[model samples]
Every structure is written in C-alpha cells, then in structure tokens.
Target: MAFPIRSAVAALCAGLAATLLTTAPARAEKQEHAWTVSAGAHAPRARITLDDSTGTLNLSVTRDGRTVIEPSPVGIVTEQADTSRELRFLHRKNRTVEERYRTKSGKRLDRRVRMHETRLSFATPAGARLDLLVRASADGVAYRYVLPAGHGDVLGETSAFNLPPDARAWLGTYRADNEGQFTEYTAATAPTGEYSDQALFETAGGYTLLAESDLTGTYSGARLAHDNGSGTYRVKLADARVKTDGPLTTPWRAMVTGDLATVTRSTFTDDLAPASKVADTSWIKPGTVLWTWLAGGRPAGQSLAAQKAYVDYAAERNWPYEAVDAGWYFKTDAWDTTDPDWQTDSWMPELTAYARAKGVGIIVWIHQRELDTPEERAQWLPTLERWGVKGVKIDFMDSEAQPTLKWYDAVLADTAAHHLMVDFHGSTIPKGIQRTWPHVMTLEGVAGEEKRNNTAAHLTTLPFTRNVIGSMDFTPGAFQRVGLRPNSDAAEAGLAVAYESGLQMFAGTPESYDARPLARDFLDQLPAAWDDTRLLAGRPGQEAVLARRSGDRWFLGGVYAGAARTAEVPLTIGSGRWLVETIEDGTGGLVRNRKVLRGGDTLTVDVVAGGGFAGIACPWRPGVTTCHR
Candidate 1:
C-alpha cells in the first residue's frame, strides 16, 4: 500500500504483527554505567551497549561472542571541538515495535521489521538537549541523533566505528561519476571524499555492511574515513558545515551484520527513509530504454534521425522508452548541424512527435552544468514539457556537497512538477531517495558495464553490494564480448533479472540483438520493474542466484565468477504444474529449453566460465507448445 509522509507510522501499524509495545524495565544483570538493548528472535541475538557516563556506544553479536563495534563516542562535531565530550546522559527509555511494508518499486516485495528501539536522552552542560535514537534488529543496528527545538551549526558527526586489529574491509573508491570499483584494504586509510559511504567489513564470525540511510535530503551526506593509526573509521561529512535552526533529525547511521545473504538482503536503508512524497504515482512508468549513444558517436549521437531509428527498434521490440544521450542540444561533429540552442531545436520536437506516433517515448539528456543558472530554467524546463519528453538523464554532478544536494532537491522538485522522470549519472550513490520521490528511477553508482574493462566478477559482486542499497543502472544487454570474455550471452541475459532498475537501459544496437532470434525473443518479454525480488543464493564476487516476479510470471537468473561451475537452484513458486523456459550458455549461442515441473522442482544449471543463466516460469496451461533451441 502507498503511504504519504504524514501517514507512514499509522500505515505501518496497520500491517504490524502486534500493537505498539510499552517500555520494558531495566534488566537486573545490566552492566554498571551501561544500558543494553537486544534484538528479537529469527534475527541473530545482537546487543547494543550505551555507556551513560562517556556516551560511548558499542555493538556485539552475542551468538558468536564477538564485538562488531568497539566502544566509540557518538555525537555531532562543531567548529569548536567534539560536542560529545560536553554532553551528560540523563536517562533512557525502551520500546518494542514491528512493521511490515512492501516497496512500491524496489528489489524486495515486502519487509517484516521487528526492532528494539531505545531513546537515550542527554543534555549539554549549557542545558541544550538531544536524543540518540537507537534501533537494534536481528540483522543490524542503526542510530541517529535527534535534536530538540534548538541547536547551533553542525560541522560534522563524531560517530566512529572502532574495529579490531585483524578486521578487513572492502573499500569502494569514491568517484564523481559514482562508477569506481571496490578494492580490499587491510587497513583502510583514505582522505575525505575518497571512499563511498557504504563499505563491507569481514570479521571472524560473519560479514557487516556499513552505510548511511534515510537521508531525506536533510543533512549533508556522510562517508567513513579510516585512521590507520588508531584503527578507527570516523564519520566524514560531505560538507564542512550544515546549520539547523530549531528541531532537526540526523540521518540513520546503520550497520547490518550477518551471513552474506542476510547482510545483502537487509532493507534498513528503505526502513529509515520517510514515506513517498508523490501521492498519485500512477503517472510514474518504469520500462526498458534503448540508448543511441552506446551505438552511435557524438554530434547527433542520438540525433533526430538516429533517435528515430532507435524509436523504430524499440517499437518493434515492444520496449517503452528510447533515450537520447549526450550531444543532443549541440552539434559536436563537423558533419552535423550547428544548432546549440534548445529554444530553436526544431528537431527535438519533431523527434518526440515521431516517437509518440510510434508508441515509444523519448528521454533527453541534460548536463547539470547547463542548468546552473536559475533564469535559464524558465525557458529550459518548459520546452521539454512541451515536447513530451518522458524523462531526463542528468549527468556530471561531480560533488556531494550540501550545495549540490540542495540543487538536486530543486531539480527534482521542478521536474516532478513537470512530471518528468530522472536518472542520475556522474553522481553520488543513492541513499534511498527513490523511496521519497519515485520519479528518480536509478543512479550510476557502481562500476557498471559502461566501463570498458568491467569484468564478470564485478557483475557477480554487484548484486550483493551496491545493488542492495538502491536501484543500479548497469546498462546491461551487450551482445559483443570484451577481450577474453566468456559466456557473454548468458551473463548479459541474466542481467535482465539480476539488476534492479526502474529504467533498465539495454546496451546494444538494433543489429546486434536482431542477429540472435532467441535472445531477441527474451528481451522482448523482459520487464524493467519487478513486483518482487528474492536472492535464492549468493556469495560476493563468486556467484548469485536471483528470482523476480512480475504479474503471474517468475524470472530466475544466476551469474558466476571467472570459473565454470554448476549448481541446482530451488524455486519457491505457487502450487501447480508450471512451464519453465530455460536459457544457458551454449557452444555458439545461448541454448533454450522448455520443461514441465512441479512447484518444488529444482533446476540444475551449468554456467560456462565467466558466464551466467536466465529462465522464466509460469503456470502451465493446456494446449501450450514448448520450443527448444
């Protein structure tokens, strides 16, 4: 069910397993000077301890008897110094709450949350007060500072995670385009803005995913910067300052700890975000997009005629959108026309009109630098609206500073007013903004297929890492393989099911996909957005098995690392005979098969070295013929 911001909590309660729980009494065996909160059943028995005297918080998983987070002081930092040292803890209260909600558009269908919530109230020496709200779940823990009625400027947050000496971290490099690769660091030490906000930590017992969530465009974004000398990772704020007048709440600082599947499957990011801002979301449409820049060069790259050709291709394949990438407004080549002004771009309106006639919509490209002037927007935005452009791919937003974020908010608000969908390229990773504004479809935050040297291992690991927090625009479905690339067809086909993006941009020319009839048939039936998503099996950088449902059909995909392997994946489908159409790597092309199986049947698939597999399942009906290739 859809929920507005004002009705979020109430709507959540309607689907919760029980009523709002009352506060529980302090435990008799509690440690001195420490208040403890533990998670519920079905989740690992995790405990979070808060030191009343020093305001230090530590997290531990009791099942494995390991401290996930060492004692770390938590509070905001100002220009003067660390504010945590000056605060004195007053008292604390606890409650138990459960919430069940399904995403309107996302990877998972629904989430059942049972958390132990704690509110630790504290006051500064000068009488100013704030509450550190902590919520502990079976799979993870999150805490945020809640300011009450009054506060000064906040330079940054002092929240830090002190790890053990032997801990290792999977460090994701920071890029203005948000398309850098992840690397393993023994002792991660990076300057501010050098690492992405989310990172993976490997402990003796299991994996821990660290990230910031529910940003809500309030405070500046924050990443973790490690100090190798002290073995601590501190909160690195995007900007040097952010001012709050009266009441303001900070973003949720979260850490999900468990096995690979459990850690990657956590939805704490969406849980902490506010409800949808768009009330009537029937206008938002997510579907496949055919881009011309990947196939054509700049200067009329996706020009009028080029875009028309792609429009015909999209219509022929039943795809919904065709995007005009960079170089649309201005001519970049000597052979093209010399028109740079949008007001006089007669070809744009002509292309949009022609695309509309063909039942295919147009997505235009815009450089953020071109929209820097507010006065220019008076003329720029209306022309696209008049031309009936379905969306805009905004690019080259190279900073995550407060000013940039504020600018993004303005752009989104204006575009929403004009009913234009958005895809952000050359930007920071998404921090659950899609939950707030459904119009914002996907972000280019991973080392996607756009990079020339992107490998199969990168594709396999993405499902468990970057794709977990938000939608990813990997731009999959490339017919040609890179040097030494094996099993390209199966891997590319599996991407249709593995990656989650509202606008799934397939990367190929018409001639490329048209050459393979079976592959083209599969692409014709692919869905851009899914009703449900489940990770059947996954191991980071190795392999992943995924199943997604759209309407009455279920799609399964599996991607393997750089080696050949075979595994039997179990399906969770409805009780009935089903028709399964399978595709796997073949000697020359992808091999297709049709089979009749029960709901509980397990299918064993063999993946070629550096390859993958994809299949579809639906309830079998009489008089249905099976096709094999």
Candidate 2:
C-alpha cells in the first residue's frame, strides 16, 4: 500500500500534538479562534467554519451575497461518541484536483471538474482519530467523514441539512419504485415517518438538493427523517446491519445548492465514486434489449418459441441484449417462487446456445428473495455465467433497510467477479453504483414504460430528478400510447432519444417495430452511451427539448403534455455541414424530412398535445441540398 503523503500526515500529527500538549486554560481562548475555509467561484462562495474548541462545524453557501444554505450544523454521531462534542482538533490540509473523464453512460458524454478540498483532522477524547473532508466545486459542496485504520464499528453518521423554517421541499417518499410522487412540504410541516433519501429544497435564494453518494460495501444506505414542527432533518441509517472493523469511510453526504439548471447538471454522485472496478471493460457492452414482461405475463412470455421470437427481433435491429424476464426458469404459481418447478437445469443451456448463435445475449430475471443468502447467489450466479448469460435482472428487493443495502453490494461484488452484467428491477434508486461497478448496466427505479402508460409531463420532470443522479431503466421506445392520450409515432421515437439509461430496453415487441417502418431508423440509432448532453429548453413539469451526442452524430428530441408547443433547438455540431433528418407527427403516422444544416443552425420543432418529435443530424457533403423525404 502507498504510504500516506508526509505533508498530509504532518498536519494531522500537529493537530494531535496540539490537543495532547495544550493546557486546559488555553481551551477558553481556542474557542474564539474559528478556522475558516472557502471554495467555489467568486460569485457563489461556499464557506465552512470549524470551532476547534467546541468541536462544532457549520456550513454556509452564498450566491452574490444572498444566502443559499443557512448556517447549518454539519457533524456526525456514533454509538461510541458524537463528533460535535468529544472530538478534539488535529492537523488540517488543503489541496486541489482537476479531472476530465468520459461517463460510461448517462445524459452527458464527458465530465470536466475542478474541486478545492480541505481535510480537517480530529481525535476523539478516547484517542480515536478521524478525518472530515469537504470538497467545493463550481457546482456545489460535498462533505464526508473518514475513519482511521483502528476505529471500531460505527453506529451512524449525520449530514443534517437545516433549511430555513419557511423553505419548501420536494420530497419523494421511499417505495419499491423510486418514481414515488414528489410532494411539497414546508419546513414547519416535517415529513415524519416518510422515507426520503434524496430531498430537493426550494430555499429563498435557490434550490438545495441533498443526497448520499458512493455507498458501496463499507457503509449502510441512509434516509432523512424530521420531527414535526422542528424543521430539523437528521440522518437515519438503515437498521443496525452495518459494522466495520478496519479502516472505513462513510459515503459522501452532498449538499448541492444552485439554480435549477446548475443543480440538475451537477454529477457529484459520479464524481465522488472511485474509478471503474472492471479493468477490461471491453466485455461490458450496453444496448437496447427486448423485454418480454411488458408484452404479457409468463403465460405469453416464458416459452422457447416466444424467447426465440424476441431474439430474432433483436438481431434485426442489431440490438445486443434480449431479456427473458421473470418465469423463464419454469413458471411458478402466481409469481411466487415458493412452489417452483425449476427448468434451468433442463432448458437454459439450449436457449443460451440458440441466442449465442444469433449473436444475441440473453438476460434472465429472478426474484431478489430467492438470492437472499450468499450461498444461493454463489451457486446460481456462477451457473448462469457458465451458461453464457450476459446479465441478470433481479427484482422485488423492495426494501431500503440496512441489510437490504448490504445485500445489493454483495450481489454486485459476486456478479462483477464473474463478468456478468446486472440490472436491478423493483429496487431503490441508483446511487453511483455504475462508476464503482460498470457492470451494473441499469436500474429500474423510475415509473418506466412497464406502467403501460405515462404522461409527457411526468417524462419532462425526470431529467431534473431521477436521471440527474444515476442510471434509470426507463424502458423507452413504446410506439403505442394508452387511452385517449393522442400518442404519435413521432413522440414514441423522441422518447428513445430524450431519456438516458445504460441499458435502453425497448418495451415494444418485434411486431410493433415491424408494423411501423418509419420509426426503424430513429429507434435503431438510439445510443446506450453519449459524449455530451444539452438541455435546450425545459421546466420541471412542462416540456423538454433534450439533445445528446455520440461521436459526431447528434440526436435531438422534445416531449410535452397538455397544449401544443414549439421550440427552436440550437445545434453546435462542430464546424461542418450536416444532414438533419427529422421524424415529425403527421396526419398519417410520422412524416420524415431531411435538410442541409450547418454548425450554428437551429431546428424548429412543433408538436401537438401529448406528443413528441425526434431528429438526427449527421455529416453531409457541401453540395447536398436535395434529399430523400
């Protein structure tokens, strides 16, 4: 192991010496000396002040002299001791880091970040030493606590986000699906008993989004709870399942404060996570998959002929993955695995071999309960890996408790070791797992296409909420619209582009795609990863024009509900001419058009109520004015 840097260690050593050698009389004067640190640009300054004598740390963020995060108390609590009281001052250090890297999947193709960091060293009265790290960037501020090598098991930690008493928050309660409707609550009216892991607060100055990041195997997942009429939010760790003996670090409890766009665009969760654990990630391929669940239940889905049909469909579009959803290994009574007539020993090899011949990978689905024990996971995961299964979609986890959180880590660790990809269904929202384990292609946390029908308005709000933090298995590309929703082929095509996911599983069956030939081009061009993303024009619940680029090709689309709307989407497709192809809603299905577009061209798109449009722009010859319709 690399030795700790001498400079950083020196600071900590000095801090420990100060606390050990100082006389009791000097504590009175030390209380008055506040250690102040600042970060971010000149406009929006983020300041953290630590009172060494009292062991209290307070954070305040400001934009143009207006307060964003009020003087909020920032500290941690454990069964052994509370940092706010018994923690004594140790050495401190400051540093800066700059990075530019590509995201494996998500809205943006690449990320460029610069962070200024301050590390405060502290030693408990019991002689335990720890470090509290605060990192400030142009986007927001994030802080986390680090326990030294010999620190014992932890009870809990805190990242209290104390907003103004009058501030209102958009709170999402815990549920099986992360798509739980967000309700507004005032600080005075605390959401007691509500399970809110990610909370977005609307303060007087701007928005403050609080979330946890990089929770792997070391720590338990946490949610926030509040007392009625107190307006004070505290961190509630998942049960008492988490225990650490060696060196351990808690997840980063990030508090991002900014305007709507600034807050939504920040990728702090991904930034806080370590690099990819899968070194040779060449085998990790992400693409649209064909799911059999949305078509019907196992009666219509779980047969050899039915799966082969889906594989045939995947081959036609050159899609890499095809999911044989739940009940593939013999149908059980009423979706319960208790009385199972298992068929994996007999038929799985035949199906996998068949798919391999057609150059299509198979993903099987199983219930999380079935793999609750490590022995069960070890036995089945390796067997599936040997059978040439590319991935597994484990569902019905449905719990945010501490043990459940630990189970997720255990499953991912085993799956990654075997080079098998994973997709979590009926599970909690993603929290930077993709960066830590790139093999975790996607997670089904949102109210995806599996619901049969969804409004364009709800689709618009996702970009700012669910999709911002992590991968969403929002299974797009459903050509059919439910009820009297005025669905159009153009809108269906647009969704395939607008939404972000590592695994872009299409809900439409093979018959649906073959029925509408006009959408084939747009659907086939959908990318599993992107180089950059630009949110052209949008609000939370109105309309959205999202543009994403992969390589030199750019895909743009817009979705809206209610009344008809129009948007002028600007393009910066480098310094070259290109051919812009658009599929728009028409009287009969979709209307296709192609035109010559330059680097600074703006494409105007109009769609009726509950409608959308998708277009693609690719490089073209300078003299190409006449094109196919």
What lDDT score belongs to each candidate, Candidate 1 first?
A: 0.73, 0.73
Show the colliding residue pairs in model 1.
none
For residues 1-629, what per-residue lDDT tens digits would candidate 2 score against the true structure? 24558777888999988887786558755543344444544434556666665767776777657766776676666555566655667777889867776656776757776788878887777876767788877666777888766555676665666778778766666664566655557775855765456777777667777777888656777777787676667777765636777777788877666777676666877777777677777778788888777665585446878888778878887888888876666544323333243424447788889999999998888778768898777767887888899998888887666567779878988888888888998887777778778888888877777664455666776666677778788777665534523356677778777777788888776677777777876777777788777776666666666777887778877777677667566665566887888888877777887877777788777786777788887778867553232
Candidate 1 global lDDT: 0.73
State which candidate has the highest TM-score: 1
Worst 10 residues of 1 by lDDT: 20-29
**Residue ranges of candidate 1 with Cα displaced over 4 Å:** 1-32, 44-55, 59-70, 95-104, 109-116, 164-168, 184-194, 227-231, 300-302, 331-342, 484-487, 572-577, 598-601, 621-629
After best superposition, candidate 2 residue 476: deviation in angstroms?
1.2
